[model samples]
Target: MNITKLIMVLICSAVLAGCASSNSGAVYKRGEARQVQTVKMGTVESVRTVKLEGTKSPVGTVGGAAVGGIAGSTIGGGRGSAIATVIGAIVGGIAGSAVEEGVTRSDGLEITIKLDSGGMIAVVQEADVQFKPGDRVRLLESGGTTRVTL
Candidate 1:
């Protein structure tokens, strides 16, 4: 029964891992300032919807393999249990990886901008804000990252 509970927890973890988005392409809060610099001034040239793939880590595969191997080991007798454990671990690893990828998918936006410096650039970020053509914006730099904001 301990192994069964362990398997359940791992399954839940795999599901949750796939559903998590680590704000790779997200917006910063208004009025929230950090050690910041303005990278550029620009106008929105276009906005397009895009998809952001979810995070993929070995955690899911390892967890699933452990659970699968433990569960499989409980079946049959002697050598049969060992064979089942290996098969189960293989199947579980594949299924867990696929699940993590599918669950973590997210929608984003590709924003094309025409900079005042006479250059064009595009940023793909989580579509949490509405942007339209001709909107004035600025590129804020914090650390090694840049964000486009009004």
Candidate 2:
């Protein structure tokens, strides 16, 4: 493979990555105004790790395929080169999709809270904040999702 083409392919992959994102990592979306949420005081009972689903977008696969095809076409002449391009596209697409998933996947938490009012509830959200048992925390509820913040 041509070194220059390979470098170009890697650059394309990096550029395309910004086109795909998952709602898994951040506590809130940037630049979007949020409404006031219902706040409930509670004590952390337990905190456990959870996996946030990764984004599934065509950006990575398409970008990788394009890059790979271009790189592979440089490999030989005529029919053999065409075959290599096709094979390279297929393999690159799959690899790119896996890489995207790995990059977007996030660590989450399953927090069990004991509400001061005498009830137990669990909230699962991105583990952006640290929580420990016996910690005083606030449960913020809005938009059908709940989050625990210090």
Question: In model 1, what is the error at residue 28, expressed in angstroms?
Answer: 7.1
Best by lDDT: 2
Distance from true location, Cα of 71 in model 1, Å? 2.8
Angstrom error of the Cα, residue 22, model 1: value is 2.6
Off by over 4 Å in 1: 2-7, 10-21, 24-34
User: How well is each residue in 16-120 modelled by candidate 2, as lDDT tens digits?
Assistant: 567655443244665335677788999999999999877768877877777777767877889999999998888878877777777778888898999999999
Give me the displacement of residue 76 in model 2, in angstroms. Answer: 2.3
On a 0 to 1 TM-score scale, where does candidate 2 land against the true structure? 0.82
Measured on C-alpha atoms, candidate 1 has an lDDT of 0.76
lDDT of 1 by residue, 1-150 (tens): 685857676676856665575444354545545655757899999999998887677866776677677777787889998999899889877777777777777888799999999999998777778889999988876666677777
Candidate 1's TM-score: 0.78
Misplaced by over 4 Å in model 2 are 1-7, 16-26, 30-34
